[model samples]
Target: MRNMLITGGAGFIGSNFCHYWAEKYPQDKVVVLDLLTYAGHRENIQSLENSTSFAFIQGDIGDQALVEKLFTEHQINCVIHFAAESHVDRSILGPDAFLQTNIMGTHTLLKVAKKFWLDAGVANHHFHHVSTDEVYGSLTEDAPAFTESTPFAPNSPYSASKAASDHLVRAYHHTYGLNVTTSNCSNNYGPYQDSEKLIPLIIQNILQGKALPIYGDGKNIRDWLYVEDHCRAIDLILHKGKIGEVYNVGGENEWRNIDIVNLICAKVDAAVVASPELLVRYPHTPCATSGDAKSLITYVKDRPGHDRRYAIDPGKCHAELGYHPVESFESGIVKTIHWLLHNQRETVNQ
Candidate 1:
């Protein structure tokens, strides 16, 4: 039975991973450390409180003493580091938090892990760094998807900090022979995601009868991966990936921003038609009777350093670690919309 420490376990993808691990590996103990930042909500993984195999700690990963104490107390043999300031817009607005959390916090975790797992002679130890494909920068429509060999060209402060953390993890592996693996994944959309994200924001706007803001001309492309699929890929990599290797995880489903917005509009519109009571509740929404939700679409100024396109080549993950996203964008987006409609409907009602 392995004791696993998962950092940033209250955020979007991180919380989903925590629930996945708790449900899938009953023999293992899962410890979650989250600072409950703006992106992280305790309610995301609060359900884990019912599970005996799961535990939560409110703290920062940069706290060396706290991190080391948990290491010793739990005898943690596995670490899945997900703590980082991940929003590109937020990073553009203020980069200090990204640097402190992504770079310095990662360094502290690496140092403490190296000391605990190596110096203390802990066995069966593994460190997995979760990352993003934005570190490879944008891709032209004709350009091939980002492979593991792609050089780093992070455009935003968020991606830059993540790139630096990636380098630190690599340095530890090379300099100290720490058993570490990294996975760079594409965009993820699923339940419990922050509404600030593109998909969820569109869904929320559709439900609230607010404008669906599209960035720029809305032609920027992104490869979308379902959060569950990303969680599965991480699980596979943490267990089977080779040490000192980086794997790219993607859904291979690239969609333009406008297209996704339109799709969500269409789905939400159809759902309202089927459940007419939804219209009664959200009477102000365009779909109350005849109007289409797409009418709410409003193009706005794009954020600075917004990448034109991002795609990932997960061929290595599939061939080596047997990883492939199971949810298609169409299916995943539907699930996300349904989840938001149910959960956020309460918000609208309130």
Candidate 2:
């Protein structure tokens, strides 16, 4: 059985991956290392605590001592590195944290992995780095989607830092012979996401009858991927992907920002109508009180260096690894809404 270390396992995508992995590979040992930052919540992985094969450690990936300890204790042979300062707005406000965490932290992990796995002559270890599509920068309305070979043209501090980490992973493989694979994914939206993200923020604001803020004209587009599909893609990569290769994982479901907000509003409205109990739970919602949730849409100034569009071409992954997203945007959003509705108290507290 594979003994794995999953960094940022308390964060949205990471936590979802942890749950998916634990369920699918119960015989394997899973160790989670997270810094418990603003976005990472212990509640996300509390359910996994009861499992005998799972362990959670509250720590930073940059802490070399702590990382080494875990690797030694757990006999970690596979690492799914996901811990990074991921918010673009936060990165714009404070770029230093992004550099420290994304670049330095990744380097530290690479160092530890090399020492323990390569220096020790372990031939079965793998390091998989999770990254974002923003590293390819913006695309014009009709430009082709970003492929694995897309040159890095990162626009913001966040994407730039991610690009740096991606390069470090690649360098570790080519120069040091580290068995590594990287997957750069599109915008992911699903359960357990922090309220700061667009989809979860919109859903929470609609439930509270707060203004739904849209940046610029909200025409900027992003390809949305269901988190579970991403987990599955990574699963395939771990088992079958070529070493030292990069895969672009995406749902291929592109939607404009305003259009997504409108869709969520409509879906929430329909949900409240279908289940009257939701009206009682979220009485402040415009949808619950004979008003459309769309009435609360509010436009605001756009952030600096905001990319106009990002889409991913998953053709390589499909042809090579048979990777395809199973959830449609509609179904994924519905699942996210339903999850937030039941877990609103926990979500708001987070």
Candidate 3:
């Protein structure tokens, strides 16, 4: 492709994809459009400032007139859609924004892209929609991973909205012969990620000697994929996967919530050589108990509509695109902790 448009490229995964695509295809022009909401950060792609092949536009993908204008003015040959309201807790507090940006926003972009593709002809363009495994709904730990054929049973407004957008994308491909491919991926953790999510939240709180809260019994499980690996999988699917097909991207890394927290504590302790910034001990707090960070464990009420488990069956992408995750949970977790350590320190005085 000569020119590509990536919506929400300032957000976590989108920003990673932008860097991935720019470096992979240096000759192509890459434009990033984002609304710069709370989760979208300009600093993520700040390093791209001097790259002539990269450009950033501050705007919402839901704006119809703006989307049409981009299609016409850029002569965009392909689109990688990543914009959406993604946090489950945020969606619970405000469902309207989720519906507007996730479903309606995707619809508007797809419509404009369809018109452009038809005018430009078929063989040279594509619309790659990035989505989440949450769209497959929660599953029991004993249940098999959600495959491409898994039936949708979204439990939260966030996942439901994504499912709605997925359906719209499917309809466009089937009814209009639009070349489309969708990927439903598991949880992603890496640098430049917003701190509101679970991993970063735990890192921030634990580092500050705050309680490491886990909801309910903390048995909820999720397959975690490193952001870089996820971007690699998306790149493969975009260039090689079949049209009108959905692929599942997973790391095969699963851990119980409490286990993850405890592991983080151990790793942080091993990594820290100096006294913590803040550590309160009830004068009588036993040295043995106070020394271990796990003493700060606290359980809260379970989240409303929280999924019990989510795992992805990536056989389709593995067989077709020859994709494989490079990091094991142990290795990935260490790298994540190191990055969090350095990043938290970097942002401390900012």
Candidate 4:
């Protein structure tokens, strides 16, 4: 059984992955390291705290000494690096944190892994870096989906920092033979996601009757992947991926920003109509008072350097690793809305 060190395990996609891994491989030891940043919450992984195979540590990934200590103590044989300052708007406002965490933090992890796993002659260790598709920049409507060979053209500080980290991972593999693999995925949506993101934000706002803000004309497109599907892809990669190679993971589900908001409104309205108890729980919602959730839509100026479109071609991952996403947007969004409805108290307080 593998002893895995998962960074950013308290955050959105990371927490989901932690649960997925722990449940799927009960014999393996799963250790989570997280800084509990604004987007990271303890409650996300609270259920796994009592599991025999699970452990949680509140810490920074960039702390070399702490990392080394964990490596020695846990006998960590695999590193799934997911920690980062991921919000594009946050990065635009404050880029220093992104650089420090995404670039420097990743470098520190590489150094510690090289010393303990490579220099110390440990065998069968692997490093998997999780990244995003924004590094490929904007794509015109007519442009084909981004392939593995697409050149980097990051337009925002967040994407740029991720791109830098991606290069570092590649350099570590080719230059130092660190036995690394990277997967750059498209937009992910599911339970436990931060409310600041588009999907969760819309859900939360609709529940509270707050404005559903759309950026620009809300025509920007993004390929969406369900969080569990992403975790499954990573599982396949860790087990079957070629070392030193990069794979693109996507759901092949594309939706425009405005369209996603509208869909959520319709779905939430339908839920409220079917279950009147939801009206008691979220009394302020438009649907609670015979008003349509769509009435809350409001358009605002777009953020600077906002990419027009992003889509991933997962052909290589499918052909080589037998990876395919099972959740369609219709079903995935339904699950997400249902989760938020049940967890409204905890989700809104956060």
Local distance difference test, per candidate? 0.91, 0.94, 0.85, 0.94
- Identify the runs in model 1 with alpha carbons over 4 angstroms from their true place: 345-350
Clashes of 1: 0
What 10-residue stretch in candidate 3 is worst by lDDT? 279-288
Error of 2 at 338 (Å): 0.8
Q: TM-score for every candidate vs. truth?
A: 0.97, 0.98, 0.93, 0.98
Q: lDDT per residue, candidate 2, 73-141, as tens digits?
A: 999999999999999999999999999999999999999999999999999999999999999999999
Q: What digit string (tens of lDDT, one per residue) describes model 3 on residues 108-204?
A: 9888887888656756788999999999899898999999999999999999999999999999999888889999999998877888888887776
lDDT of 4 by residue, 1-350 (tens): 89999999999999999999888899999899999999999899999999878999999999999999999999999999999999999999999999999999999999999999999998789999999999999999889999989999999999999999999999999998999999999999999999899999999999888999999999999999999999999999999999999999999999999999999999999998789788888888898889999999999999997899999999999999999999999999999999988886465633
Minimum summed lDDT over a 10-residue window in model 2 is located at: 341-350
- The regions of model 2 sitting more than 4 angstroms off are 346-350
In model 3, the runs with Cα more than 4 Å from the true position are 120-122, 274-290, 345-350
Ranking by TM-score: 4, 2, 1, 3
